[model samples]
Target: MRERDIVGREGRFIAEGKVVLNVLLANPAFALESLLVLENRLAGLTGQIKLCPADVPVYCVARDVMDTIAGFPMHRGILAVGRRNDRRSSEELILAMPDKALAVVLCGISNHDNMGSIFRNAAAFEADAVLIDETSCDPLYRKAIRVSVGAALKVPFAREGSIEAIVTRLQSAGFEMFALTPSGMTSIHDAKPARRTALLLGTEGEGLPKSLLENLQTFKIPMSANFDSLNVATASGIALSRFSRFSGF
Candidate 1:
């Protein structure tokens, strides 16, 4: 467990806290490997713990031992190791989404918190899927999952090779890609939603690369003076909210 603490063990990820543990237990997409909880927490989590397959082990340990194993103060008193069972390639993910879909495409978003929040927003707005480029952080990173409030577990996502590859696949799949940037040719409010829509976002400082921006339809959230743009995650929330409302979730 301690070894997994530093770097997620192989393909395994640590699901921490009561809420994240619950999501891991309830979601079949994640295959349970093992569970460790402070003895006091065992009572509260017993019901859910029992739902795990008989083969999956659940251990109750002293708080100090748990903390030592985690290499930190284990305030949440809960931890579980799980692996994703239904991994899909980017092409497959795009092909599987609904004919009328709304998705978020991320490019070069390195911050884990922003990635987590983006997933949370995607789930909140009932987005069909999230497509992240190679430059983005892993949504399954321990901190990212916790920041997402378990929304990362609930939402389906695929990490593709590059922004260009992602755009190509989405375009081939009949998606109308709208790149979100400050120098957009159109305003997000005036842009019409399509049967298959993708809202593309980039990193905070540089935004989307010129190559991508030049090729795709670009739109921006109109803002007042003094501020040129919003944070990537904030902009994503605003855009997702607008798109979901326009397209009926």
Candidate 2:
């Protein structure tokens, strides 16, 4: 396949899990930066956009059909195949996090905007990496990136496939998993944010699935008596703000 048009190199695609695979890269810069950020293999590479792998100039000829194929606009201009990060045991992520860190866990959230807003809030509230359940929308998706102004790129993340696995992992690592529910048992105002806590927020439409609901320590964002629930992203901002200042580390 002929390399795609010469969309000028936009630096690199720097993220974890989404790299590391021996992906048939159409653009070498995006592929290389994606893997090098892992620190596992960070040697013998200049951090510039020079085409060192001279045999394969960074080119992908799919731009003409990309929009029709992906069902969305291609903002990043380049595409590649990369494996999603392995579901890290919740404990592994928790232990790696700082003491009393405020982290947001995206559970069953599909709207790219909602996903981006969650991360933007996490960064705004000084929260640590945003944790996403295995079923959540990718924060690195193109629209998500645009919506987040690349804040999704700025924050760190640990992705998990199962709600139970993440809860068990976080619990084992000494982090509380507060499941946000409209009909939850405790209100956010009365709830205390732990120095090390993970908020498990559900999607806006269906709320938490019964399986996840049964597993989480639920919390409600107290609202005007008549208001049923806040939009998932907005509620996250409010909840995150409560914990932001005390995280003074």
RMSD of each: 1.8, 8.9
Off by over 4 Å in 1: 1-10, 245-249
lDDT of 2 by residue, 1-249 (tens): 111221112322322222212221333323333222212222322332243245433333354565454445554444432223333455556677887577777778999899878877886777776777878876666456556654665566766667677777677777887888888899877787775778878889888788778867788887777756688999888778765765442
Evaluate model 1: give its lDDT: 0.87
**lDDT, model 1, position 118:** 92
lDDT of 1 at 48: 85
Q: Please list all clashing residue pairs in model 2, or write none if there are none.
A: 4-59, 4-60, 4-61, 91-169, 100-195, 100-196, 101-195, 134-160, 134-161
After superposition of all CA atoms, the RMSD between model 2 and the true structure is: 8.9
Tell me, by lDDT, which candidate is best.
1
Candidate 2: count the clashes.
Answer: 9
Question: What is candidate 1's lDDT per residue for 1-249, written digit by digit as tens?
Answer: 454454445567877898988888788888878888899988898788878899989889998999888889899998888888768888888989998898889999999899999999998989988999998889988888998999889988988698899999999999999899988999888888788999999999888999778888999899976865688889999888888854554
In terms of lDDT, the poorest run of 10 residues in model 2 is 1-10
lDDT measured at residue 61 in model 1 versus the true structure, 0 to 100:
99
Overall lDDT per candidate, in order of appearance: 0.87, 0.61
| TM-scores for every predicted model | 0.94, 0.65
Look at candidate 2 and tell me the lDDT of residue 201: 84
- lDDT of model 1 at residue 202? 95
